[model samples]
Target: VDTFFGDTISMVVIMTCCVVGIIVNVFILVIGYLDWATRKKLPNCYMIVSCLSSSRLLLQGTVLYSTLCQGTHHWNVLRVQSALLVLSSTACLWFAACLSAFYCVKIATFTQRHFLLMKLRISGMVPYLLLGSMLVSLISSVPFIWTDFSVHLCNSTRSSVKNTTGDSTVGNISYFKVFILYLTWMTIPLLFFTASSTLLIASLWRHTKQMRRNMTGFKDLSTQVHSNAIKTLISFLVLYFCSFVAEILLGIPSCLAKSRWKHSICSFIVAVCPSIHSILLIFFNVRLKQTFKGILLSMRGRILSPFVLSFVLIIN
Candidate 1:
């Protein structure tokens, strides 16, 4: 009964993540598309964000399908599904890292020559950076395919009873390989994200100090932009840190301590991160926020219009 209850809770959490993630990512994509349709060209940051949203949508869909398959005992396709999940997740993370770096370069006031050069080139380099990230993600997913193949081959060669020890050995090796892959793929992006956010925060701090010294009683447009940028970066950093810790906990065998509940909670957290972060992005971005508000207002008006008309008619 306890096991059944745990499984039910896990399923509920996974489904919620999938549903919310799909909705949020779809909304992001719609906003991106509408922005592009109106302007005819998206800025580099928005372009990357669109890509991130698409990747996240794919990831969520895959997770949803994978979860359903697990319950239905249709495990045959999970190998490919796992590979796709890894690919999508990698793309999502790298795009987010690129977005952070872009914001840091564009918003931070730095006197360094390298910083200036980066600021100048970032817009033009975004496409190539995204392409490179895709290639890296593809490379990272290749090992998963190999692992799947190796496991299949091993299983084919021996009977289940005879291969118990060999299966255990292969499982251990697979886990180690996955752990290494996670570390390798995640480390550079995590470092880049941390560095960019730190630089932006430091720049904001220095600028605030300067404004105080100058006694600028009124905030300028530039100051407001810096303040907004700081808020956005800090919010993303917090979400990223939480998701990163959850991912690390899920990846490390020792960390789980054979606790199914811990594993389930971490899985749910990982699944929910993209959705939560995307919602935060919408709130922080001016255009997206306005667009969201317009949508809400329109929805409210539509829902209330008929009732309002009926009430007015009765009053008359």
Candidate 2:
């Protein structure tokens, strides 16, 4: 086996990615936490942000650890760190599913109870259920701690222990099994989400049509409501599509000649997913910019206050 130098250009790029991921996701968490405070009622927007932030926190933590270890000699903590990375990745996937389900149920049920359920108490529980289910499912990854990887690189980076063609027969099977688990998780919940959201949109369309027929006045609102529902559905659909691509990449053949290339591509998707999700949220939800502004102001205040106070004390 030819030992390539320990440091590589790929490592540098991946570390840079980790830093960016950490920065973006941390901002998301801060903004989400702050926005959550301002909400007297838990709108679907609140649940979306909360669940997305929960997923990104785990992602950011894993990236931080990876970044810290970058460029260092391969340490022996791969088994433990790899397990943690998997757990974090799994948490992100489950939370995403939970988010979709939350919105599906939240909107679907809202159609029935819109008059009375527009209040705080009922709406707030939607996010709790999403986050709670994600936590429980992610905890199931604890058994990964005992399994050993022959190399000391993180799971996403590790190509596996190769013998003949630089690929492991056993490792490929293991990854295939994990990929199946991810597929099942993504498939089942999103199936329900797609079905429920379809029904919601259909029902909304019909109701909005009826309203349009009845209204002798400003008639754009019915159309506007239908448009908003379409936008909301599109946002959720994009998220699912992105995740679906990622899942398919995970199941790719490990023994292929382009296996390393595939791994590199998959890493980018896994790394950038949260940021992409953030951009989608910002695009679809106008309130996102407001929350972002508040978060930025809060950060700026924290950063500058110490310096400002120190300068004032010296002058006085």
Candidate 3:
């Protein structure tokens, strides 16, 4: 896999991925927030959407800092992940779980108590909760960030450097705590997400089947919207599932043993999913695709000479 421009290509891809992920997720958040604001009285669904978008997007920063800041000791905290990624990811889980619960109640119980619904909506509270969780995550990761891990300024090859894990005992404990959080917070919630969504889908399937052939009218539109929302959520879930696997493949072994290359590869992979989602959304999303095409057209002057020359070269 290591070839000419290997590291260069990988770094570019990683950085590009971060940039795209941040942009797309931020775009999603902005859309969600705009939707919430447009309706004056924010609905529970919009609130949950806003929360999910913001939390997922914020993860872009965590991954970005972690990926770009590699091969360093001083600012190892953001690069390495501590409480930041964990807590943010966890909060995302809670928010999604809330969404799932809201849907379940909406579908099953079918409530119409508008006043009670207003009180139940958590959009207003999301910002404070996010801010608090973020602070906790960052503060907790300090110990996890390799302090003594330093490299000589003379070395041109940054990846070849090693992390000088400072104070073995404290580091070990930090790692253990991270492990616990992984089990209790990250892994558990991921599993919960799968289970809860699975159950909801199953129930929905049974209900639809009971109602005979197919759905129509406003019920159909409502069902379609719900399905669309679920599909979007599924996208996030699939990405996170892959992330969990990558975390194991890249993180566990090194945390248990001592291998920098493996850890480095793992770190790179960790940042991949968020970026992948961004690129997919930008390229495939109808609106985003149109916008991207517009930008390309606007910049066609700069791109054309090189493009035409490359085309001529290929033809010749």
Candidate 4:
């Protein structure tokens, strides 16, 4: 009973967090679309962030469904759910990597000819890169269609399946192959994300140091931008690392069989990662932050107006 209650509480928490994450991503999408409608163009970085949010929204929805159906014995449904999660997560990682690359090119000062050329052409290339990411993610997810989720789950739960059938060994081998393939796909984008973020940080640090030595140590616009970008990248790195580790741990069959509560914690981390990062993105973006503040103020006003009117009527 205690175990069941704890699992129930974990599910509730996961569901609530997923709901909040979905709302945050929706707000990001709405804000991005409104800006694009008004201006006829969304900035490249914002475009990437918007795409990331959309992917994360899908991820959160998948997580919510998976949580609600945690006890589901339907292998086909679990297979589809796993496929969708991989697809959405791959897209999110690719988009985030692209965002980091975009930031590096636009803000990092490098005098190399190749770097300068890339900076010049990156804006025009962003659309193609995003489309390519989607295509790649779709291809990566296609393998899941053939996966035997029953065997996978059986192995994960460490049941004595081999005693019943020789096919269990073959199934395990196939599952391991697919798992490695998926990990490779995920790792590629992570490499890009880490490299680009690291390069940007190094460039910013050097530039800031030079500025500090030349100037009177007052924070100028460039310095402020440098500081903010570094902070955002650092936060992103930490969150991304946590999610990556959680994903790996969750994927391991041994890890899953060892401690069920650890699985819940990893799920919570994965579900919350995109939402927390999106919140940080909003905080860093001036337009989004201002718009969010305005919305909150308007909501507060609406909530208070009726109470104020009731108080006035009572006094009169």
Best prediction by lDDT? 4
Off by over 4 Å in 4: 155-157, 160-173, 254-256, 302-316
Clashes of each: 0, 0, 4, 0
C-alpha lDDT of all candidate models, in order: 0.74, 0.55, 0.55, 0.82
Model 2: residues with Cα > 4 Å off, grouped in runs? 1-21, 35-48, 60-76, 106-128, 148-179, 204-232, 251-253, 256-258, 291-316
Q: Please provide, for model 3 over 1-316, each residue's C-alpha lDDT reduced to its tens digit, 9 standing for 90 to 100.
A: 4653666666676666667767767775665566568777655565565666576676667766766765444334533454567655566665655665555445532335862474366456555544554554455445445422222211343342344445232232334445554555556556766775665576566766754565443366545545654565567568767766766554352324354455556656667775665454444344445555554556555748567555434423
lDDT score, residue 7, model 2? 34
Backbone clashes in model 4, listed as residue pairs: none
TM-scores for every candidate against the unseen true structure = 0.83, 0.62, 0.63, 0.89
Model 4 scores worst on lDDT over the 10 consecutive residues at 164-173
Q: Per TM-score, what order, best first?
A: 4, 1, 3, 2
lDDT of candidate 4 over 144-169, digit per residue (tens) = 76665444554444662233332332
lDDT rank, highest first?
4, 1, 3, 2
Candidate 2 achieves a global lDDT of: 0.55
Which parts of model 1 have CA positions greater than 4 angstroms off?
A: 71-76, 148-175, 253-257, 301-316
- 182-249: candidate 1 lDDT, tens digit per residue: 66897778788889999989998998898889985786778887887788778778877777787677
Comparing 2 and 4 by TM-score, which wins?
Answer: 4
